[model samples]
Target: MTTLADIAETQRLAMLSLSQRMADFETHLKASPPGADLTGLHKDFSAFKEHVWGVFSALQRQIAELSRSVDVIEMRHRKKFLLLGGVPESSGEKVPETVASILQSKFGLSDLAPSSLTVCHRLGSASDGHARPILLRCADSKIRDLIWRTKTKLKGSSYVVSEFLTRQRQTAFTTARKLFGVTNVWTMDGVVNVKLPDGKRRRVFSVDEVVALGVEHGKQLDQEAPPESSSNRKSATSPPSIRSRRTIKKK
Candidate 1:
């Protein structure tokens, strides 16, 4: 499997190669006699520059493809997980029971048992009276999907449930929302969906895709990113590591 480390190393090597080519070009420029024939040297330099550009572009394309592939896999692994925000936080509360109560009361999943949650807990520090979001791993993906679909019932409530997207995708989702308005932009199954003003629909994966669809297609970048009144953020740069939090076993 291609890891982020592998991608970083690939980029480092590509940059190193480009740096060497630059150094070689400098050496050639310095070694040329004061009044050497200009035509052949210019032609050679042009060809060398194009060659380096081609290499760099190819490397960039490869890295983007690799990152997308890794992102797809990571989201697939989180298929059974869901993020629940705005629940009241308390000291040493029973997370599984609390989450189950929300699922039962709010989402109309009354029949859903607390045991269905393989893992559940509040995320991050409890400082400043902020309610820490809960991360839940359902025993079945179907239940997770059901909860997400019924999220509209939470429209007026303080609670919200969202996809456990990777940070890049989360940013893309938020940027799409800012550009297109919250009504036109949303995430479905971890893919950011945007409805353009022209009545066209676009699904974006990365932040770059979001920028292209929004800023480039709609208007200028500076004009499109809406002002920040409240920093409404979702997810993180990387998915929270669940290995240590996987202590719960399904009943």
Candidate 2:
């Protein structure tokens, strides 16, 4: 089984190789005398640089392709799962039963059964101010899709249904919505889709892709640092001036 670490290591090795080649080229350049106008050396260096760039670009492209494939496989495994957010919490609650009830009473999935869920539980601790979202893994993918398609029915209710996206994809979805507006951003089958200003749709899979979308749409995605608090700030005092004591000369 191939892990993300394996892909990362492959890319790292490619980078290392590129760096070594660059160092060799630099050494060659330094070895040449200042007055030596060697046209052959210049040609050789140009060819070397071009070859290095070509190889590096090819390796990077392959890495990106492999990453996309892995992401697709990982996301496919989550097709039967949906995240239920904004559901009120209770003390000593039965998570699966509560999720079933919410689906039936709130989302109008009256036929959804607690037994249909292969796994259902709150995602995180209830200590956070926000309600802990329930992760519902349905036994059937069709039911998950049905629930997802009807998520619009949750409007005005404190509920939201979303796909179980990977961390990279989740970040991209959030960034796309922030940059392009929620009305223009959405996800379908784990792919974060953004509707550009020109009405063309773009799919983003990572934070970098979302940033590229922002650049394409002329949105300033650079985050400005927050103002530092001045409550405990002390005044900047100058260092104490050292007085040069001159010996009094008695004439």
Candidate 3:
């Protein structure tokens, strides 16, 4: 016996409840400092509960619609999942063996993996030198931060990350040109290759550079040592190490 009128009334009530709850949230946010704990206050608000329920209901409806659409597409295609593996036969023309070797040996990519797994590839242009450009395979904030730190530590190198391959490379090349004011900055598709000490090659980028910088910094600290006056140094070098430790323990 649920009529359209009843549904309308229910929706109107939900909207009013949600609005009141949002107003309470806004008031709390205004009163609280940026890092203050407001969990108890949030839980006490009735309006917040209503607002959360409404959001959950809306999400459920959208998910149901998406499920139906996916079912239809799968029925039509006679496939449960879409396949994005392998290069298109049309573009499978002979490429350099070096490119293949680099992808497998350095980047640790499987020969028959899906195209999506590769993320992006940048082809070398005539203007850029022979140095292979870096390829970032992951899409995440942590990875991005790691890469940025690495780039900054690399004394004379730079890097960029973009969700889109075309735009990222173009931006990288442009930025490198401006930063170094030099045209010899390299660009290439996929991974950047560096020669190893044992006559082998490896793929490395800003992420690796950051790690190397951290290790180098640690070594430098060890070599330079610390001034004797420092509490840390005194504790380490003191004749009565146990007494110093006990004093700190008492404190």
Candidate 4:
């Protein structure tokens, strides 16, 4: 019952039906006109992006504040700590004994109590078998302050001592040192010091403070003594007028 002529006629009818459907779809799409306001959409998206960025920026600020607060707390906890560098390390070494010996012999602090040594140990993760800095904690705040003040005495010796400060403060101190030179910069109890041209020391506690000090130091170096003031220079350069002691009588 299915002949060649019948198959040809069915294929023709299917192709005609598909063409009609496509034409109808095109007509519908043209009628709809897709009137989406692309400009308005872009503006809305930009606003949304700006709002998101604002929130992200606020989060970044909060994270920075959190980091700063944590640093402050940690620095407060480490207020009684000191770092001793360039000390030789040996296997099975007793840190407390070595530190005590150094303090007594080098610093001449023979009266320090044994109990005042709260903690003492070498710090760092060196695998190359090098000596690391020693972290020593004292029980008394006054003793710690004294040690910090006297650390400068270790300058010529093989061993050197420094206050244990927060990483941020340490970085600021390094920056200050680079800016102001080694002789003019020092740190004590997390405070940075810069010796000015006037031979006075200024205390700086933050990176911003260090930067401000650097700017001030630069200004001091670049500044001249106001060019000696033009009036003062002219007066000094001009010869004194010869005045007659006797006044002439008027006719």
Candidate 5:
């Protein structure tokens, strides 16, 4: 013998629970950094699924309660009809697309700008283990800096470097990989083209790619310069000894 008031109260409670669950999900999403490990993302999405199911359950109960509250049978039938007409609770299909659409609609395209895109074309080994496309956003400057340092360290290598401007960093990397048979891709602050040893070409990040190219340049310089023998090294090292002897003589 549930009264209309009781039904209304139940609906209110369900709405409140839904609101709280939605809030919690939002908090989790906000706290998570972009490009978080895929394994961790699976866990987050699992929780989100649970919360969404909870919301659907609550809403279904609310609808049932509202249908029960109508005095007239015809009126109750009409209400039921309206409820049925309403969007059905998701069966969990197209979750990614739905979420992406919602984000795009709410925040617009500009909100999702990538913080950095780095592309490494050559990484020491013949396999080019480090050459890949990398895309990172949100406080990934440390990774960018590491790539930059690596580039600078290898700047004297035998490579050609060129920079490009483009909106899609991933596309650039894909293009580079196809062109140069690169195994890895990195996203960084900017874009560039790197020429490989086999006369192949690829798109790479400006900072790190440039640094690697610089290393190649240095290598070329070393090749052109005369090699220093042990005697030459000893001569170079003898300057301090000579200076010390001269000081002793003056004393």
Candidate 6:
């Protein structure tokens, strides 16, 4: 607002103040130990990562436990169910009549009414090219149990009935069969069994159980060449039972 010399003096003073501030900033930066701070930050992050992993691990364990519980419940529900395989498909066939006949004749189930069966069906579409299995659900668990026990009676017959097992159990059954042969491996109400080294059979319900057996005694079993007897092999491959039903259970 006054003379040019006065204005220039003010400008010079302002520039000096800014330069001092810049110098101070540089000095403060130089004094600070950036590497030490970085190390502390890294340590903090590592601790956080470990804590997260621990939480995740616990969650995984809980989920695994829940899955096992669900599997057990499902297997229990299927305990009263059976699968009848190898019934020929025909058009205009009386499915209920056929079922009644089979139960009366082949299964020797007397005085069973149509209402005694809760569910019955051939499982899938005819386009699958394979013979559809029959899924039979009885009103009483006792009836189903009786039918399941009589499966051995149907041995070498054109029709066969087997316990309905979950897919995982089925896979385990197949694995046991591969290792232990047909006779040594069988299922009771979806519970898989394999003959042990001591001539005693042990129940195996999970794939892990079968895997452990293979890991522990696979070599010894193979060395012993414990092949299935000819009778058992014949029974295993023999034609499965056929019951009249549209509800086909998956093998």
RMSD of each: 4.9, 18.9, 23.3, 28.4, 32.3, 20.2
Model 2 per-residue lDDT at 57: 86
TM-scores for all candidates?
0.77, 0.72, 0.18, 0.61, 0.21, 0.68
Query: What lDDT score goes with residue 67 in model 6?
Result: 55
Clashes of each: 0, 0, 2, 0, 31, 13
The local lDDT score (0 to 100) that residue 69 gets in candidate 4 is 81
For model 6, the superposed segments whose C-alpha errors exceed 4 Å read: 1-49, 113-115, 127-129, 219-226, 229-231, 237-251
Decreasing TM-score order of the candidates: 1, 2, 6, 4, 5, 3
Model 5 superposed RMSD (Cα): 32.3
List lDDT for all candidates, in order.
0.73, 0.71, 0.36, 0.64, 0.37, 0.67
Model 3 residue pairs with clashes: 122-188, 122-189
Candidate 2 segments whose C-alpha is farther than 4 A from its true place: 9-32, 37-44, 89-91, 124-127, 223-251
* Local lDDT at 57 for model 4: 60
Q: Give a tens-digit lDDT track for model 2, residues 1-251.
A: 97677877877887788789788878888898888888887788789888878877887788788877878886777666677777788788888888888788866778888998877877644564556667777777787778888877766566777777866687777776667765667788888888898989988898888888778768856653223234211111111111113221211
Write candidate 1's Cα lDDT for 1-251 as tens digits: 97766877877887888789778987987788987777777788888888878877887788788888888987876656778877888777898998898888887888888898887887665567676678888877788877877777776567777777876787778767767666667777888888887889999997788777765675544665443333233321123322233343333
Off by over 4 Å in 4: 1-37, 113-115, 126-129, 194-251
Which 10 residues in a row give candidate 4 its minimum summed lDDT? 235-244
Better of 1 and 4 by TM-score: 1
- Winning candidate number (TM-score): 1
Candidate 5's residue-wise lDDT over 114-148, tens digit each? Answer: 32222111111222222211111123445334333
- lDDT string for model 4 (61-154, tens) is 6655766787778677767677777778887888888888888876788977555687777765543656777777776667777777776566
Write down the worst ten-residue block by lDDT for model 5. Answer: 238-247
